[model samples]
Target: MEKQHSFWEREEWLKPPDLMIIGGGIVGASTAIFYKKRFPKHDVILVDKGIAPEGASTRNAGFACIGSVSEHLADLAVSGGETVFSRIVRRWNGLQLLRETCGDEVMDYQNTGGYEIFTDEKIYETCAGKIPWFNQKLKERLGLEDVYSEREYEGYPAIFNRVEGAINSGKLMRFLHERFTESGVRTWWNSRVERVEPGSVMFENGFQINPKKTVIAVNGFVQRLVNLPVKPARGFVFVTKPIPGLKWKGTFHFDEGYVYFRNIGERLLLGGGRNVAKEEETTDQFGTNQKIKEYLTRFANVTLNLPEKWEIDVEWSGIMGMTDNKEPVLQEVKPGLWAAAGLSGMGIAIGMQLAKELVSKLED
Candidate 1:
């Protein structure tokens, strides 16, 4: 049964807000923060279906990276040098913005560096040959020198990115949430959105709000509300039981970043194999793909060469939005309706910056 609102609730708390932000992930929270800071007098409310962010924002592998050498080469081929280099700059600047907004200590950010390991010698050689060019371009763009260097790790050919690192995803989101509340933005949890029209949004629970403006920041789930080019890609992750002598302690990627792993103290956290079965993984639903899991399991055993009997302690999957060009989608879908999504699995690196830019557009 619907509980009718009292006079105080209807007139005050239940009244339509100045802005309604759907989806409480990094984009939504950052949007609220920027907007509230700009207009403290206006009431803003952010709603999410889960108690916490349900998408890749908090569920990701916590890799604070721009792009690996091999990944960049592949992207450069498809997107051209100019587009690829511009994206690299955006990612680098976005990472800086995230660290500045939520402090390094608060998020347990570590400059442990990132390594792109390769088992195929030919692929490794090709990537290594492009290191100097990549370094020169990155230096010119980001004012950072020696960004990529050829290296060897555990007997495998690797290219180390000196600027890349890792962070605690949960803590990052927690800090963002604290900032969201501090900025006087209201939050409505477990409130799944049923529909988002031009002027009003209806919740799954039958509650309706007619806000002056609405922003959809659901990422992978954006398609559920409106038609867009963004598509959902499910990625799986698993953390192993404490390995007594785990030595690898930094972010690592392979197979053009289709697979990645890192160390959390004495335990190994591995994720990403969606490229193994792209068609199957391209759905909004959340579940593990056995084929991808099998591939990753083989990689952990054969490529990573873990302890003889290492075991997975926990495993889960997260849904991320993907675009053909691997760029975020930020635009007004219709009058009074806007959307910001398709972070392309780089939410940690670009979510905040994208939010800031979106807020600027909303201002106009």
Candidate 2:
């Protein structure tokens, strides 16, 4: 039997909105907030398939970073200097916008800096050799001087970025939810969208909404809605039981930024071994890759050198949208349908800024 909503419920609670945003992740939340703020008189609604964001928005390692030296060097080779630097600028500015809007206290942001550790001496020398060049380019592009400096960690060569930091991902998303709610944005959780057109969205529960404009901010799940170039890539992360005398703090990355770990108080959070099994991780489905898990376990022991007795407190995975060129996809797809996705893995650094840019276009 089909369920039915009351007339009052349909009219008041489920009334067609001026703008409907599908997906309650960082991009969707930020878009809703900006849209409502710009046009408060317009009715807006944000719907998500899960109780919380089902994507990388909240399921990240919480590094407030642009890129590590080796990561940037690799990216620069593939996409060239112009494209890479432009993306970094957006990332840097996006982090600033996120901090400004949410404030430091609410998100528990800490400027603990970021480090790129190297076990291979050749790779370390290659990245370190480009430090002066990178610093000069970054200074000219982002106006930040001497961003990268040579450093060391536990006998391994490292490069540190003074501006990079860490944040509490859960707190940041909660803060966005509260801000959008306070700004008159209606958020509907556990409301799975079955299909969406330019002006109509059909729900899995046989309900439908006809909005004037619709935005698909689902990131990794965008392909389930439209024919976009973005592809889903799953990442796994784990947290460990508190370790006493854990002096190591701050975000750290290795393997060309494909692997990362950071200190959460006295415990440790480590993730990213996707490159180990890229083909296996290219799905939108959420599940643990045991092979990758075993590889990371060894890495934690051998590379990170964590306490031998440390146990995993929790483990989870998130899906991130990726493009061939490592650029985001923010554009209007149809007459009234828009997409703001393909943040790659930099949603924390670039989600809100992309949202602001997307909302600005809707003004005209």
Q: Give the clash count for each candidate.
A: 0, 0
TM-score of 1: 0.98
Instruction: Encode model 1's per-residue lDDT on 1-364: one tens digit a residue.
Output: 8688899988988798889999988999999999998888999999999988898888899999999998998898889988899999999999999999888999999998999999999999999999899989988998999998988899998999999999999998988889989888989999999999987999998889899899999999999999989999998999999999886779999998999999999999999989889999999898989998899999999888898989999999999999889989999999979999999998999999999999988853
Misplaced by over 4 Å in model 2 are 1-4
lDDT, residue 19, candidate 1: 92
Q: What is the C-alpha lDDT of each candidate?
A: 0.92, 0.92
Candidate 1 collision pairs: none
Q: In candidate 2, what are the lDDT values of residues 1-364, reduced to their tens digit?
A: 7778899999899888999999989999999899988998999999999987778878889999999999998898899989999998999999999999999999999999999999999999999999999999999998999999999988889999999999999999999999999988888889999999988999998889899999999999999999999999999999999988775688999988999999999999999999999999999999999998999999999987887798999999999999988899998999989999898999999999999999999943
| Cα TM-score of candidate 2 | 0.98
